[model samples]
Target chain A: MIASGYLISVIAAMGIVTFALRALPFVAARWLQRHALVQALGQFLPLAIMTLLLVHSATGAALAHAGWPWPELLAVALVVVLQWTRRNALLSIVLGTCLYVLMRNFLV
Target chain B: MNDSNDPAHGPQRLSVLSLSAPVAMGYVPLGIVFGFLFVQAGASWWLAVLASLLVYAGAAQYMMIPMLAAGLSVGTIALATLIVNSRHVFYGLSLLDALPRRRLLRWYIVFALTDETYSVLTTIAATTSDRQKLLVALLNHCWWVLGTLIGALIGAQAQVALAGLDFVLAALFAVLTVEQWRTKKSAAPLWFALGAYALAYGVAAKHALLLSIVLSLVAGMLWQAKSAASGEVQR
Candidate 1:
């Protein structure tokens, strides 16, 4: 009985967050789509958000230190190279991840 | 790169068909990490699989597993999920403009707003055929769903490591970073994040980091307008 209660709660909680995030955009976007300012923001938001996200995402492993995690930095450099040269998403992720794992274990 | 053939700022239609293969390629390994962590959190495969299928927010789902396993309240999990995924709100702001006004696509677009999908779909110049973009979005959702399901199912097959799995999100972000740098004409994201992080750290004192993301988005928009105006004046 207790376990089932927990299960129900988890599912319900998950449902709400998932549903809310999905629904908010539809409502917000429809109303905001025709606005000049909103459209302009949308245009530039991608570049800004992507940059913030990159910095946001890389908050793992190493920090604002230099030479401490040269391997990780080098792997990131490779990811940048792959992204720039080929624009291949999956390939860069795979290569960057593999390089990091190998470097973390072997080099470090 | 040609001015006449520029794909950016192009008129687009809802893309037909799904880009499942590409989406899958991106999601599988990443989802494996989510599954591995779910197991590490002491949750059974059933719980993790169901959440991955239904909830489907990669970062938060992973975060939820540990909290849920710890017997935390549903509200707690939900709140954490909201915080981790608050950025999704901003992601929707831009892409929603091009979204199909129809019923089904709207629902799917909202549901499929994963970071990877948003990054890929948003860059195809606004004018890319909407049919293609819709297909790409649908395919991207399938890839993530399938990846999560497969990863959770594979839980018992072998030992799964959670230690390094956290890095997948970072890696995915790195991929997005490269994407933005290559195609876009602006460096706003990089500068926004740095400036926002600094501002957030300075003013927040003890507030959530999410405030920074929101403020940064607003500041970024304002900064873009100012820069464009300056360029026009200089020209």
Candidate 2:
């Protein structure tokens, strides 16, 4: 195992880099705001990014095992349906997650 | 606006924090999961706290657990983090006009802008004061940091093997994506994203996320450009 001091330094490096990524745009806000491409990205990119994240998460789960990730797939479906019908994010996520945990423990 | 005379300093600051209550539902649980996972990866609770305080990006921090265990180089970790959180740059673009001109507050807001806060701020009425926006940002930041610290403490003590809890991250993203779909009323972005992901997965499952994100963005921009050109043609 790496030493604690080295680990702490790594975390600090991570923190610095993350802060830089976040702060760069605000520092150049004027140019970014006026850029047509950035404007278009601002409008449409969130949905795409969100969708990519969903797929990435699901695929990560699925690829970890040889068989299908039944619980994950089911939980995602349940979450989507719940959010669609109820229009409540917290309820859907919390419930879907609980269902996934239960399925992972018992159903599998 | 004037930095010294900020509205957040006004009497209504409490309400701004209250407005962020909805975010607690997601941040609290997710933070706990991250803390638990961090400890499970053999890191101390203090590391989890340090991460939450410093790297506060939820998904990126979650990804850090596996990367840390693998003993990857710092450069790899930093690059992966940049790719994952690069979406924040877009968030900054959307919030730029709404942000206060004061240097410190602006920097804080920019640093604090996560996916949930961005969603909340963007949907808030345009007339909402800068102080309220700052409050929302601050409250969410506090919720996440505190939640992580609490979770780390519990996790360090219990050492409970809570397998499958990591799925919370996936579930959170699923909910967010569904919410976006419902509001936007267009399936093109979703389709493009799915297509890119599938293709990238086929080509390289390990690097599929980064590849798919790049592919999806390219496809989205191309589609937008084509549609705009067609509109001009019709006009």
> What TM-score does each prediction get for chain A alone?
0.62, 0.70
Per-residue lDDT tens digits for candidate 1, residues B13-93, read 222223345557667767776766565555566666666667777666655654566687877677656645655766776
DockQ (Cα-based) for each candidate? 0.35, 0.55
* Number of backbone-clashing residue pairs for each candidate, in the order shown: 16, 0
Q: List the residue pairs that clash in candidate 2.
A: none
By summed lDDT, the worst window of 10 consecutive residues in model 1 chain A runs over A57-66
Instruction: For candidate 1, give the docking quality class from DockQ.
Output: acceptable
Estimate every model's Cα lDDT from 0 to 1: 0.64, 0.78
By DockQ, the best candidate is 2
TM-score (second chain) of model 1: 0.59
Per-residue CA lDDT of model 1 for A1-108, tens digit only, reads 126567667867876787686577667766665555555565555555555555544543555224486755687788888878888877887788788777766566
Most accurate candidate by TM-score:
2
Best by lDDT: 2
